[model samples]
Target: MDNIKLFSEPIADATPVIELFDVGMHYDSGEEILSDVNISINKGEFYFLTGASGAGKTTLLKLLYLAHPPSRGHIKLFKHDLHYKDRDAMAKVRRKIGVVFQDYKLIETMSVLDNVALSLRILGRSEKYIEKNVPSLLHWVGLGNHMHNKPATLSGGQKQRVAIARAIVNKPDVLIADEPTGNVDPRMAQRLLHLFKELNKYGTTVIVASHNTELVNTFAFPRLHLEDGKLIKYNAGSIWTLFDKKGDVNV
Candidate 1:
């Protein structure tokens, strides 16, 4: 791995990358999954969404990625109000966000290279570009040797890496990951975090939902804590200096 800067200079003119105003989500069964949620994440900010199982961490991420519309209240992405229903507009907005789902969601029938290259392909990138970058990205994620294998043939950790590669290949402006390190080993989890941190340095706002408390404590980034379908705690600060002093992480 290369020695990439873990943190970039803070943006003095911080722009809201994601904003939620009294956002709420409820199911058809009248069960509320999220309630009165209000939060704002700025460009280049990295946050960990920590909560217990069924605490609505995934629900919140779904709202940001435009997967689930808020049952009530407002959501603003890149400063645009998200109150109206506009398929074309939503599709355009979604193109700028990358998501790594907990299920990995890899195509079992496709080779690892093709699976990781799907994002670039959907963006109409040329085959030449995919060929040039996908392999290198796979190598970076420790999946280079398995590029020709199908997802079903890979281990849980390998599939997770492939999903990560696919989500980030196009360099989306915002990245949302749900339990991205759940299946990987501790070392690999650190590596994945480093990748996300590197991307953050390049101006990508990242939100990672995880149940790994130990991993969360390793970084000093602000945390979004939810309980009983509501955001109960939020801390804002830099964890870079602390991490530099405490860990010998490469890149």
Candidate 2:
């Protein structure tokens, strides 16, 4: 707790885009998934969420993306406290956060272009604007040739690319990706990361949940590691703790 104060004290001028304080979660079976997790992610920062297969990574993501409420404690996104009962308010805040699920969650009936264009469409953009920008974004993700193809016709990696393109098209205030690179080759994975990097440069906070150590090590972003239902923030590429009293917070 002292270290949380230390880490937060130096950055008083900058507000956290996402804040979790003494948060905890559980399911119907009465099993606790996370406990007392405290974290604050500032604007424009990129963090890699790393842990084992069932280490509550996805569960934590569900909370961050505003899909579920914590069983205890508090969560604030974009400075608004999460009151899960307020569906309208939750939906409004959700629109400002883009999420790429582990399952891709694409509509099998829709074409690649249509899927990627859905976000812009929901925002009520004109057809002309959608037509002009969607193709260019698809091409950037190397899906130019598959714009008209449906999700059922594409491979796993291709579907993942489509999901990435869609999540980022609206340029939301924050982007959350769950195992975003799981289906792609190393080359394509790096390319996708570069895209996320470009978006972060433009002021979008990014959090990528992954178990891929090689890929995580390739970037110098600070990491939030989940272990035994607790959270620890660490400096990039080091064992030095960011939220422990003995180590300094460099992120």
Query: Which candidate's TM-score is highest?
Result: 2
Model 2 worst lDDT window (10 residues) = 1-10
Q: Give lDDT tens digits, candidate 1, residues 82-119.
A: 74478888888888898998899888889999998887
Q: Model 2: which residue pairs collide?
A: none
| Local error of candidate 1 at residue 55 (angstroms) | 1.0
| C-alpha lDDT score of every prediction, in listed order | 0.80, 0.82
Clashes of each: 0, 0
- TM-scores for all predictions: 0.86, 0.87
70: Cα error in model 1, Å: 0.6
